[model samples]
Target: MGEFSKTVGEQGENLVSKFLDTIGWVGAQSGESIDCCKSEAHKNPGTNGRKTHGIDFFYSTKSQLQDYTLDNVVMSVKYTDKPYPSNPSTLFKAHLKDLAYTIECYMKSDFRTDNNDEHSMSGIKQANDTGVLFWFTNDKDSDQDVVGKVSTIQLEKSLSFSSIYLVDNSRAAFIYNVIKYVRDNFSEYSFYYHYTFSSANYKGADNERYGIVFPVEYLVSNILPFRLINKDTKKNVFCLASREQFSEESINRLLYLASDISQDFTDEFIFLFPEYDPLHDNKVLMKAKRLVNAKNRAPNIKVLAYNNDFRGLVNE
Candidate 1:
């Protein structure tokens, strides 16, 4: 790779590493070389044997919400200076194939065995290998949804691998903006990811109520619910960061949802949307508040806006 290409790649990897830190996927092993399983090496007809696969980043962690399960995530990052290609199916397919091959080799490689012993916790029954592809661009328009563009592509039946997740520019933007808003506005309070129905509710499960990592469900959730608490004053704030634009109906529903999930100790509720203008939304917001208060639901909820553009966090 040329110096320019290498620099762009490093930038993307650094951004992803910081994001992983925010979500509590820390201590990842990067730039690893894992020996290719013979099964994979034999499939290729090349004269010279390809003996190793490169892993951009790898992490293994016990699931906070899933009982007795560990998640091993393999990550691949691609950063470009141009907008997404007009026909992205070809590129998406190639990326997926490469990642799938990496996962296949990783599952059988000694690197995985050695790390599992180091990272796996007690009582874990099964470990799942997951692949995550972070494909992004630094173009003027960096908010394109790459997943939607490739959603229509049909995978070949012969192509087999574990679950894979794609983080397009837009998805990453939503997650980063949420982090920026919280850190900028509520830097003092303790952050906690709220447990939902998806969390293991059974006794003796590792369903930690306080953690920096988000349950996988929240990655695609319409609303990301979390909490903040000031230990000094016992002030508890429950928050929901929504992906959609501000809407009266959505606010009303989210208020009720927050009320249902929020603890009695919660002192306030904050709802974040992509954009909320008081000049146009104040009346509706007031009406929603009144209705909720009339029903004796959460009355302390307030609405605000957050940056949805991916580029907004360039300096962050």
Candidate 2:
């Protein structure tokens, strides 16, 4: 297992490096300047000695054209070897938080200077106004045919980032063109990946996302209502709880709470179950299905089996 793990890790890192090189090649072809940073200051050196930092490919332009500013293109490379778990919470929150922090710090520092002069700050300021492109790669296990996976991050949102995953090789050319567009036409917008958790939520995990505990009734009542508050929104709420905490009676009670809340605000309710073969002794899946199919259902309810490959839907 250790040897296999090492191979997986190295493969992931290699894919990320190649992706960065591709970005550099595309930037150079378009007459853009590129720099790659290798520093422990950008990475979180927690208990593990490993240090990782931002943008394996950092890019800037030599000439300005249209609204495109030459200083706005930046790219980061991330490599992950582990298989994505069935549930989002299964991934370590600390690791994700540190990654987000490193990116945030890198962006701020990339454009900051001590001189603060108009011309000097202009270059840094223009760069700050420009958005960053993040290329994320993960190596598949031996069973899978793909050598690597690629994804793009959009950093337009203030508190949250958005990402779209693409298959390897297929989108390589398109990725370069988009980077060029940001450099010349849209230097003011930042692009980032919208991971399951946001930087703020991850930083304040103990107080916000994973730390607080609520009664089963309170949890059911609040989740969908909070989602409904924004009509036309398709926000996903990821809940993590031990199956041991659920019972037929408790499940029915929670269903009742949901039904009551739905009367005030009507919306579709969909519950996703893990796709992998059953391993735990608990009957959480069975109970959840039963509750959703109950005769007293008020709002429309749909139950979906989970897909491991699906990227997270939650912005935070």
The 0-to-1 C-alpha lDDT of every candidate, in the order given, reads: 0.78, 0.34
In lDDT terms, which candidate is top? Answer: 1
User: What lDDT does model 2 reach?
Assistant: 0.34
Candidate 2 lDDT over residue span 75-116, tens digit each? 433345544433323232333343444445444453323212
TM-score of each: 0.87, 0.30
- Tell me the alpha-carbon RMSD of every candidate: 4.0, 16.4
Looking at candidate 1, what is the lDDT of residue 298?
A: 46
**lDDT of candidate 1 over 137-213, digit per residue (tens):** 88867676777889889886665577888888888889878878887777778887776644363544556665677
Q: By summed lDDT, which 10 consecutive residues of candidate 1 come out lowest? A: 307-316
lDDT of 1: 0.78
